[model samples]
Each structure stands twice: as C-alpha cells, then as structure tokens.
Target: MVSTALQDLFGGKAAEAVLLALFHHGEAYGRSIARDFAVSLDSVQRQLDRFERSGTLVCKRQGRTLVYTWNSKSRLASRLRDLTGVVYDGLDPQTKEQLFAERRQPRAKDKPVIRR
Candidate 1:
C-alpha cells in the first residue's frame, strides 16, 4: 500500500496526489490524476483550483482537457519540485510502484514511435 506520509504532510490526500502527480509527470489534469491515484475527481479538482489560486500552479487548455502544471514563474516553483522529489525518494518501493503505474497518451498522426 502507498504510504500516508505524503497525505499527512500535505494535509489531505488530494493535495498530496496533485503535487506528486505533477512532480512525476510534469503536467496533470483532474481526471487523469484522480484515476491514477484513486483520489476522487472532485477532491483533485478542488485542490487544483486551490493551488492555481495560490499561484503554486497554472492551468491551460489542451484540446478539451484543462491541464495543470507547476507555475514555473512562481518564486517557489523550484523549491516545491525539490520538496516533491524528496518526498518521492522517501517512499517505499511498493508504494512507488503503485503510484507510478503507466498511463500513456496517444501519439500524434504520423508521429514516430520510440521503442525502448
């Protein structure tokens, strides 16, 4: 099971999930993050709204999805990312596996696939 350390530190599950998702993926949207982390959509969205309002995050529209990412322009952006890294690195291996399960986006038309 994923540890509750992040949730305790962040004060809520949704906030922990949002920060970790963005930290892991570089960007996130409500539905995707919630689905990935088992957080409720409403909870994830509310945390997104709060972060955006606090200048900790920014939002942009990509097609129909409202994507959120860390606000690079914010003075605390780097610090926040570093803190996320610290938290992530502290997680148990099993928790890390559960948290970072695959969720790939579709490739653009005619885009080349890169096999690892």
Candidate 2:
C-alpha cells in the first residue's frame, strides 16, 4: 500500500514523466530533461524545484548546472518506477522496442555534438 503523500508526489502527468526520466537515467540536468519532454528550460527547472520541495527527488548544483536525481531512499520512487514500467509495458510493441533500444543507448551530451 502507498500513502496519500506518496500519491501526491507523482500527482500530475508532467511530474510522473520527470520521475520516470530520473529513474531511467539515474541523474540528469535541467536542459537534458527539458529536451526529453520538449519543454522549456524554465518549465523543467520550476517543476524540479517543486519536486525537490516535495521530497520525492533530490537536486544538487554541479558547477553551473543543477542536476536532479531520484531520492533512491524514498519508497515512492520505487512505486513510481513500477507504475512507469507498467505504463511502458502497455505501450504498443514497436513503441516498447524503440524505448528499450533508446534506453540501452548512452545518453547524448546536453550540448550539441556538431562534427566538422
């Protein structure tokens, strides 16, 4: 069973998406997460700030960037991950395969990788 507070932690779809991303990646910065969701940097940062305050996740400043990580100590992160896994599982086979392949691939740098 989960607590109401835990349910509130992943209340919105947007927050759930952020939690899933952190769960899968282990850690990510605002720009990377924003790009994944196709949202603005300000939007990601604001949501991350709220999530940190809610104690569902943790954040730390690394040089110029604020990196977000799931509070692995939280039981809520585990439950949320389970829910995310179920949702992913229910997706179409092709989508599931693409997500599986993408998850296996190394994450790209937050910066553009332009080759000359």
Candidate 3:
C-alpha cells in the first residue's frame, strides 16, 4: 500500500510543499513556495498565515515581501523544525530534486550575493 505519510504529517500536499521549502532552505515566501510547488499563491499564503498564527513561523517584511522562517524563540517551532527535518530526511532524492528546483528568491536590499 502507498503510504500517505507526507500528506498526513502536513495535513495536505500543498501545505507540505510550503513547509518543505522552508525546511530545505531555512526560509521562504508565499510566491516562491507556491511557484516551486506549482500550487496557488493563495493556498501557500494561507498555510503561511496559519503557521504564523500558531507561533510556528515568523515573518519579516523584506520590502513588500513577507519572508517566513521558523520562530527560533518558540520551543514549538523548534520541535516542528526537527520533525520536518526527519520527514525531509526520508524523502526520495527525486522528490527533493523536483521540489527544490529553484533555490533563488528576491534578496533583501544590500544582501550580498556570495559566489562560490
């Protein structure tokens, strides 16, 4: 039987994608997550809002964009990050590759782009 663990863990596939984007990259915005997952921006934004309200995430204004990251000060957020890490560790390589195709997002002003 095909396990629906991912959807069960995240409540929905779209929500899982949004969380995984943040987990993989440490931060993300609604539009970027939605575009990466091919889900609607509104759906991603709703998930973001839900997480933010639950104290699992915090968002700061980067100009007009609201960038979300785990709420470091909250223990619940920390535990959730750890859980997400475990789930991420179990994802197949192909799934990770596709979900994280774009690592680029609009940088905050004056954020230096480091080249390898």
Candidate 4:
C-alpha cells in the first residue's frame, strides 16, 4: 500500500512539469499552463483537477479566467517553494550575503538645497 501511494505521488511526469511551470511563475490560467507544456486544454485541466483534488494546487477566478497556483497550505508545495528559495540563494552567494548583511539600505530623508 505504501509503495503504491509513493508511486502515485511521484509517477506523474505531467504533474511535475505543471508544478515547475507554476513555481517559476506565481499564477497562470489554464490556457497559459497548457501552452507551457504544449498540451491541449483538456489534458492540462485534467492534471490540474487531480492536483486540486490532492490539495497541491488551488484555483481562483479572475474575470473570465480561472487562475491556478500552488497551494501554500500543502506541505509538498511549501517544500517546493523553500527549495526554490535555497536554489536562488545558492545561485548568487554574494547577492544573498549582501542582502542579509543589510536588510534594506536607508537613504537620507532630508532634501538638500541645490545651488546654481
């Protein structure tokens, strides 16, 4: 039973591709997601429905478009977001260090008089 569940979780390549697409871009509609994988809308919607049922993705309605994004409440999705953060940090050590060294560099608020 455990092996079967594990296989179900990791076996779907389409789901992984869809998640990667949404992870790189915050939110996307069905058509945009379909275009990312070069798949039909029906196939994309099917995968999205499965993800939604599994609680790994969530959808919101915006005008005529139904936008889908990673569900923050899902443990898997949260871990993926954390992994992305670590990857970004590792990609730019200097930038990460500088940002951590100074959270936000404040500028002088006073305005100086300009002399012609």
Worst 10 residues of 2 by lDDT: 1-10
Worst 10 residues of 4 by lDDT: 96-105
Cα lDDT tens digits for candidate 2, 1-116: 11223236556545544654665567877777666655577766777888788776788889998888877788876776677556544455544333333442455766222111
| Better TM-score candidate (2, 4) | 2
TM-score of 1: 0.82
Q: Which TM-score value belongs to model 3?
A: 0.82
Write model 4 residue lDDT over 7-113, tens digit each, in one string. 25547545544654465556766777666545577867788788788887899999988888889889987886566444443434443332233212254565321
Q: Give per-model TM-scores.
A: 0.82, 0.62, 0.82, 0.56
Give the per-residue lDDT of model 3 (tens digit) for 42-89.
888998999999999999999999999999999998988888778788
Ranking by TM-score: 1, 3, 2, 4
The residue ranges of model 4 lying beyond 4 angstroms of the native Cα positions read 1-13, 80-116
Which candidate should be chosen as best, given lDDT against the real structure?
1
Q: Which stretches of candidate 1 lie over 4 Å from their true place?
A: 105-116
Please state the error at residue 44 of candidate 4 in Å: 0.7
lDDT of 1 at 110: 58
| C-alpha lDDT values of all predictions | 0.82, 0.60, 0.78, 0.57
The per-residue C-alpha lDDT of model 1 at residue 99 equals 74
Better of 2 and 4 by lDDT: 2
At residue 33, what lDDT does model 3 achieve? 85
Lowest-lDDT window of 10 residues in candidate 3? 107-116
